[model samples]
Target: MKSVNQIAVAVAVVGISVSSGFVAAQTKAPAVKSSTATQAKSSTMLKATMADVLKASQASDWRSLNPENTLYLEMDKGRVVIELAPEFAPKNVANIKALVKEGYFDGLAMIRSHDNYVAQWGDASEKREFKTAAKKVEGEFTIKYQKDTEFTRLPDADGYAPQVGHANSFAAARDPKTQTTWLTHCYGAIGVARGNETDSGNGSSLYAVTGHAPRNLDRNITVVGRVMYGIELLSSLPRGTGALGFYEKAEERTPIKTVRLAADVPEAERSKLEVFRTNTTSFKALVEAQRNRGGDWYKFAANHIELCNVPIPVRVVK
Candidate 1:
């Protein structure tokens, strides 16, 4: 049986042999060389090598996961990095921006966590009509594909779709039947809170994944972004037993002291971070090296990696 760490967490990768030596956390990382376009286009997908990947990953295959699309939920535990789906759901993203700007999530509570389902957080008030009107924003599934969203489809069999891969640093699956792409809710994944019809969230509520993959929630809720660095702060929280896993009383709830955008924070307090870009040779090489792990620790290599199981590593550079 897989242990809790294996069962509960999913992470990303970087170029070549770095997988075994990779460090992912809210702390610091040694300098990382970015990927370049020259290496990225040298050969077609199948012919690429680990060195080719690292060389391409030199300067071009790196992009700052945009701050405007980012949210930093500061809690007593730590920071949760959420990337918003602004293109897919503009209204929902805008509402979330407003709520963040207004400090709506500050002092609110994380009220629900259903194991094997989702760990949710938001205003737990019983005032349904009032809260409904405020957060009941519309949902938009027609997302304009951004130039930054360069997806590299995976070749393995997946329960969710014909092909599974990464785009914008999130686990993604594309339906050949419909050509639709959406974020897969892997562990530590973040999503907007909403009701049955969609467009029910005012961005006042949110959730983070804590258990098994819940692919059913993919297009149902507006997945703003995901916990890029500090997912442990949420997933390790004690589970609740009240309705929808809500703590029985206010006293048991975890308080969010503040939810601020990195852009809003002072430059000194911001997280100095970079994500190895998707579809680049370095990232491809990084994933491939781990996919087989020809390194010292393994007597044999798997030569296979699950879509959700792979981690896009994050580091704080000095």
Candidate 2:
């Protein structure tokens, strides 16, 4: 009979032989055609790039600006188009519409152009008049959230609000617990300038954010709308020398030839522009494309996007 050590060595050899036989069988096995077919399917259905998503967008994916809610700021260089957010700031919008109809901002100059901050335009004269409306409308900083309100939420972490999203076409923030929603101060955001008093801003003086998003002003000030086009017309203006970017010399100010509501203008004279609707399947795809950056140029995907960083595409209807 074999000794205990000899028997153990024989058992080990047998185990090694069995393992080698199993490995050989696996190596000789035929590959599955299903894997290659799956790969081909995946390649065919690869994620779309931002450009591809936009190219695939349909006519219904875009929305036309309501003429009643659009404002055309005519200057020497060109027209600065703005889209008002009546859903967010109804009181301010009402006041602004009245002012625009009354020609309150027709000759008023763009008084301030604080670099990387805001470009404000209104009557600089001490004795400015609001011939069409009241001097003080209740502050419409935030409105009660309505369940019926159409909101398209972004899937990104925000340092500012509990929830960040877009309502209508405006960047907005909401607090579900409190049922409150307000427009954020994003690039090209148009806000009413107010004094220390809360109700002071009656839509007379307006400012457009030309730089980084100042989200701190979201619930503190009333945001009327956003610049839909010709942002460079305001952003590229010379920085004011005086404090708070007030032009020291009157001649330095850019004159506002006229600020008219698109509804008041002739159909032929109005700007033919369309904005991508936020609440659409194409928009969701567009947002995903932006978040991932599926193009070959990007070495790595970001996977996340900020609310303000998302581009709300606006194109002149061709």
Best by TM-score: 2
Winner by lDDT = 2
Cα deviation in Å at residue 80, candidate 1?
Answer: 2.0
The per-residue C-alpha lDDT of model 2 at residue 309 equals: 76
Q: Give all TM-scores, in the order shown.
A: 0.76, 0.85
lDDT of every predicted structure (CA atoms): 0.64, 0.80
Per-residue lDDT of 1-318 in model 1, one digit per residue for the tens? 223233123233211133343343545455342354333322233343343444445546666657887888888776777767565567777777887787777778778767666667888894433322354677654344544556787656787666789876777766656656777777766677767676666667778887777777776766666776666667767778877777788887788888888888887877666666767666777677556653223334566877776657554443
- Ten consecutive residues with minimal summed lDDT in candidate 2? 11-20
Error of 1 at 182 (Å): 1.0
- 31-59 in candidate 2: lDDT tens per residue? 34465444434332347865576567898
